[model samples]
Target: MRDAVWRHVDGRGAVCVVGDDFEGERQFEQLGVNPFVLRPGEPMAMYHWEADQEDFLVVSGEAVLIIEGEERQLRAWDFVHCPPNTKHVIVGAGTGPCLVIAIGAREHDSLGFTVDEVAKRHGASVEEETNDGGQAYARFPSREPTAYRDGWLPE
Candidate 1:
């Protein structure tokens, strides 16, 4: 397997395995896959919905799924399927690193960010509703490319 590439937002972010190489084609045309590594209380992304279907699998550790204003606890092997326009976000929980595989279809103009009270409580909602990702994460530090380190996963 190729060494994972990382991007950090306030010390937490995803370990991108599929599109790690930035010098060449970095994305798939029909779908996208990303493996996120989050610490306790860290959110994988802002609260949002997409016009295309998206799915998530809790590969290791635990997470809290905030979906449609409800919170659901998730553990390893748990899977979540989100249809078009299903509002959701995942926050790391439990005592260690949470590994989640996020997969989604690639459709044109397919996403929108939202501000939700439930998501705000978990630091996962944008300050204002917008379709632009740059505006949604404007207040936070940029996701700088970084080298992957060991121990993000268990032996």
Candidate 2:
């Protein structure tokens, strides 16, 4: 399970990691939560939920929060709570790494990803809701380095 964490690099050269997915030798599933840590200047593609509620927190560094097509700069310890079906994305801001902890209600009918011109400009891998993280990463390497072992990224 330690090796399951994967790395993602956006068009702007932002580094992100998938912390844990509670799969393969890991039975400790808690509310279907997943952890993602992104570097500065990287934007999470625009997306929304069909039924689940998504929430976020800044563990370190700062970021820009895009909600319903609007934007707001966030600082460390800041939190974002998205009710069901809210269209949003979080972009890393400032000069260094931005650590964001996000939680989503696992039980849901569907998840939706929207194509935003701004997201495209940021080099988001996925632009449509046809699937979760497919097209956006169609060209990524098959084997990705684990988040824990990536020394170049922030912890």
Candidate 3:
């Protein structure tokens, strides 16, 4: 009975977790791609990467995607394809944390930033907040996190 779930993990990003494939392997599953909230009037740093293999999609909110040295704004329901090793980065432009869902042909080692990984990469202190379900969510403060400039873009 596996289905998509969006239970509140934490308020940090309030990410709505979903699955890539309705029915498939766990490792190959693509979870929601999210980051810290983006406040208006503040521009978060951007990161460009050459992903060995993966693709990204903007399922909701407004995302400013810098792909192949070009910047474009993506609104709700808009989608962008970053082929393997292509340079790309996305920044939230709308009035909330942009919710992104990525589908990959095969799961890559790293799709985006995990809480812990982001903290470690940026050398920031992460605070853990527990939800009603007891799942711990990590939170950190960074006007500009390292993830801003370090992400794997799909070729």
Candidate 4:
């Protein structure tokens, strides 16, 4: 198999991915397992949830786990689990680029959320990510084939 497909979700959680296509052993469609990596200043998503669950693991560097209505500082090896319909977001915490491994079961029916406090504190311009996932991301650049590979390190 080839390398894992990476999508760089910015602070706004705006992802301009054209399609959900990946060829690998793990069936993301059937198993609903999606893996994502987050770097410094980046996050897995704004605040959103689906029917399935999502979990996170800090492989390297540091990150802040924002869940429910609180922020928890996390370092390497830290793990976080989110049950179904749990509103949560993971943001890179410290100076260095944070390496976070996030996994979640894919669910078509999901909704976005807005956390004013988190947005204000994190300097995120987005208030809420509506159900139209790619609507706001229309102006952003298309996904670069290997762009996320640059964030593979803990810089």
Candidate 5:
């Protein structure tokens, strides 16, 4: 697990479970699974949607969910189900680290990053609508492999 840990340029962290020999690349064919760790105010990813379905479960701490232009508070054990093209993003909230388990289809016909005002308010939106990840995250640093830290999950 530690070997598959990585830190995003934006300070979010994640454990890519089905990675390629610790390179943090998903190795699965049908689905992908990851556990994301986020500090307060940090977003798990840009506000975007895919052509396939996705699901998320809050494992610990708290988070704020921005979906389809609305905001909702999330706590431990909260589960979110997103059908195809349901735009959304999750931001860390409360006083500590937020751990969320994300599961989704590995293949999709399309993906898109949206320019959402609500996501922007939480620093999680792209400057403009785009399907390219590089364009959507142009202002952020790249993710790098990192040593796993303790306490990212509940004991």
Candidate 6:
């Protein structure tokens, strides 16, 4: 990751460093916050809430937003907020890349959540995740990789 500063924006939520300098980018840093540039046909890996605050906004393209059991269509300039502990997912919904901004809090200070919690809420079983360092991402029941056949392949 590159060194970047997170700044506060009044109506725009937060902004942090994202994208290559050539591609352009801004991001936010806060509990439960995460943002990304979604390529076409990219399906967000399903994950659930942990103890932390979270938020989402669409800067470009379009996407299908799933929170709890409800689903909504989002386009450029659209925004959505997921309450802490709510199961949520987002999938690309347009021809172009979906520019999405999301934020999440650290697990220490707030309620912690894992993918399993999110899956359970969404009526699916949870799985475990391991990083290249061989660290377990979730302590609950061990789960499978988000994608079985292809890495980062859209669902």
Tens digits of lDDT, candidate 3, 12-124: 23222333222423533443343223322222222333345545565556766656555677776787676765655555566655555555454454323212323223222
Per-residue alpha-carbon lDDT of model 1 for 1-155, expressed as tens digits?
23666776763565566753566464677788888888888899889999989999998999999999899999999999999999999999999899899998878557899889998988999988999988987777866677675756656
Q: Could you tell me the C-alpha RMSD of candidate 5 in Å?
A: 2.0
List clashing residue pairs in candidate 2.
Answer: 125-136, 126-136
Assess candidate 5 and give its TM-score to the true structure: 0.90
lDDT of 6 at 42: 44
Off by over 4 Å in 3: 1-26, 29-46, 105-155
Off by over 4 Å in 4: 1-5, 9-27, 32-35, 135-142, 147-151
For every model shown, the clashing-pair count is: 0, 2, 8, 3, 0, 21
- Evaluated against the true structure, the overall lDDT of model 4 is 0.59
Per-model TM-score on C-alpha atoms: 0.90, 0.69, 0.44, 0.70, 0.90, 0.51
Q: Which of candidates 4 and 6 reaches a greater lDDT?
A: 4
lDDT of 2: 0.60
State the local distance difference test value for candidate 5: 0.84
> Which order, best to worst by lDDT?
5, 1, 2, 4, 6, 3
Q: Which has the higher lDDT value, candidate number 2 or candidate number 4?
A: 2
Error of 2 at 87 (Å): 1.2
